[model samples]
Target: MNRAERPPATLTELLSRHDCDQALLAALRERRLPELHFYQSGPSVRAWTELCSSSAYRGYARSFALVDAHAQTIASALPDRPIEVVSLGAGDGAKDLRLLRALASTGRRPRYTAIDASYPLLAGACAAAIESGYPARGIRADLLRDAHCREAGRMLDRQRARLCLLLGGNIGAWDPGDTLRLLRRLTEDQDYLLIDAHQFSERDTLPQYDNPTNRRFALAPLRALGLDDSAGDVHFRLGTSATVPGLALVEKCFEFVETSTVSVGGARFAFRRGDSIRMSSSGKFQGHAFALFLESAGFRIRHQFGGQAGGQVLLLAQRRGAGG
Candidate 1:
């Protein structure tokens, strides 16, 4: 298909195939929702929006010099040409607008493509971009799957430089190796991956993830299938990966304070009073750990931005060629 005809799939059309109910039941078998469905529905989306907009999350970003990095340094580093900005798990797309505006200020014409599984969030991201006067497309696909990744990559306007954004600590939601393999399919030799990561701190991270607001967000998927927090309690604990040492994380687990049975789409799951299921794990890097983490993932760090105490980071990395 020609560039004009590609990405013809509207947000609604893409969302039609992304069945949250079916995904939820499949994920229940594992007693956990992968990052793909961890935050999957309208309620979940709204809850996450609330958490991100909360003073704690926003305040942390502000105190860490992230705003300046996004506006000036990060945008200034992009190639001076037409660019196609693609963001995965884009959420509300709030993090993208600043860099988009900064690119525009530099006399660069850039378009946007928001790839997310949530209909409400994806639509908002696309509408915001169009209202802001940038051409945009919304693709509802799970970035965790290889086929979905390549197909979404093809739907974009390939003539321009492809700059992919996995912002707002979304990559930390999944295993780093899995994320690296997923991103490699979405990018090519010259394409760029602009990613965000957070530093670990109980004092700093606890307030962000340990609150009731975040608990609601994490339990949203279960609530969609006739289960609620009343069936269990959400707990946050520091986690470490057996594979990667010195990696700190805030692991959210839902412990069944009362026995619960969930039935959805002709499938039923039973849980005992003492049974528990993992909700999600968000990774936090130590100082300079995120850079080395990305480098080891086969992405050569071209330019790095935003690394204050327990702050958010945006790194511009290029896919390393063979032996690079």
Candidate 2:
């Protein structure tokens, strides 16, 4: 791509063009629950990086096994040409690099682009790829915004083909309708979208979110925003997705036990007792429900990798009407 037309090459430029910094600053200035997504801040990004890398997290290493096992299959499904590997919400780029390595094992070396709003995480991703001698770049763009999505498209359009990764159930955090809309924005015909989701079940769902590691990961931004555990407690509850029946959701909430005040960006907001702020929610999908969702969103599933044990899953899908 021409330098003039290319998406912002650095975090500073991306932040300036997208006003992500300004929006978060404004949210903090107004003392409202930050409209910022969970991965927008440095501390939260670090917390997530740690959580994902920690040995205590199940499949911290095993998650890459799926990529290794399906490497050749994924490579075969793509157009028999050089491709760009674009990872959305790529925290630390751990799983992405594994996928890239697997592709390389299949005799394809793809240029990697890590798309995320967190500058710290984005820099780390690019740095790791470069250190490993892979051609790579980082775009600090918020995935939820349409403008950023367009910028990502421009970055990928320069390649012969594109493989998009939405690993670790990243899409599950949004409302089902918004998730489909986001997917639509992020992909074009013949492009590949690899997304993962936790299998949903009535049992063994809530415990995943109720743990300390997750509480810390989910509350990192709150603490960085200057709220302490004393001000509120982080909790999780199970809910059902109204738009997608049979889809389960884990809602992360911060509920204040007593009246308190939080100050950020020189602004202060008072919270009444018993008030709650929703931090984030993740969707859990049954295998059939996930396939139905992809089909509904105009994607044809090319391959579904991972065991059927009702946990993490990776689905490789192509925009309909094309073989790639």
Candidate 3:
């Protein structure tokens, strides 16, 4: 039997076993304590909503186009099977929805599964899927961990032929080498994977960390903790790093340089300037390097789409067969 036919664990079970919230909180605190407080305060939902809905963020649309093309390719490969399109970090499912809608137009009804760690985002995606009359379900799991991958693999095991989607620079944000290995383990011979590969050009400048919009977004949770931006020296800085041989990771760090009163979950604290608060990193990849990484992970590149807005590449890879 294919792995997609196995019974999988529930989202609740995965979350409890992983203890993601605690891990996230600890990671944030150790790296940048203020950011942890801000995240737990919960204004990121609105920020993410705004980010996805804004005209400035057209990356989703481009991603949607690539997904559509990928769906067509997968459909051609497994013409008679129920397509299982599993999206990791699905966000609002806006891009995936576009692909599903396109597939429906081609008379191919896909079983849509969205995997995400954010409950709010998953809920929103489910609602949207319901409204669209699509056969869709959501699994709330952190794609960054192995157990989550195992659970996802079990879920996929229940389906026919599978088509996996990982977009929105999600792979780039995490460790690509590790992510690719995990992905390889989850994918079997019957699956086709579609992952977004972002190209970094010298002309692409980093966004300002403390822009008015960004500051407002970051301040929402802080205010809930009775800490205003004015109550602290909130400094935001932009920097870039490399996660792999050819991938560039660029991100912004929002720090509380100084604060009079800082309280989180009822605990109170005070801090001086020069203290780092919170940081969020976004990733960009070199196309050639991304292709090489995928090949190394045992995927045979079937097709590649390039020349989109913000310089993106879509890789359609199939698992390698035995012996050959």
Clashing pairs in 3: 3-157, 4-156, 4-157, 4-158, 5-157, 5-158, 255-277, 257-273
Residue 323, candidate 1: alpha-carbon lDDT: 59
Q: Which parts of model 2 have CA positions greater than 4 angstroms off?
A: 1-12, 16-18, 25-36, 53-62, 307-309, 322-324
lDDT of 1 by residue, 33-114 (tens): 6766655667777777677667656533542246455666767777889888888888778767776888888877888888
Model 2: number of backbone collisions? 0
User: Predictions ranked by TM-score, top down?
Assistant: 1, 2, 3
Q: Please report, as a residue range, the 10-residue window in candidate 1 with the lowest summed lDDT.
A: 59-68
**Most TM-score-accurate candidate:** 1
The lDDT values for all models are 0.75, 0.72, 0.63
RMSD of 1: 3.9
Clashes of each: 0, 0, 8
- Candidate 1, residue 88: CA error in Å? 1.0
Looking at model 1, the pairs that clash are none
Model 3 lDDT per residue over 150-261, tens place: 8777867455667787877677656666577667657777477877866666554244233455556566655665666666544533345544676666554545555556
After superposition on all CA atoms, what RMSD does each candidate show versus the true structure? 3.9, 4.4, 5.5
Give me the displacement of residue 263 in model 1, in angstroms: 2.9
lDDT at position 251, candidate 3: 57
Better of 2 and 3 by lDDT: 2
RMSD of 3: 5.5
Deviating ranges (above 4 Å) for candidate 3 = 1-13, 16-20, 32-42, 55-58, 68-74, 77-79, 208-227, 231-243, 260-271, 322-324
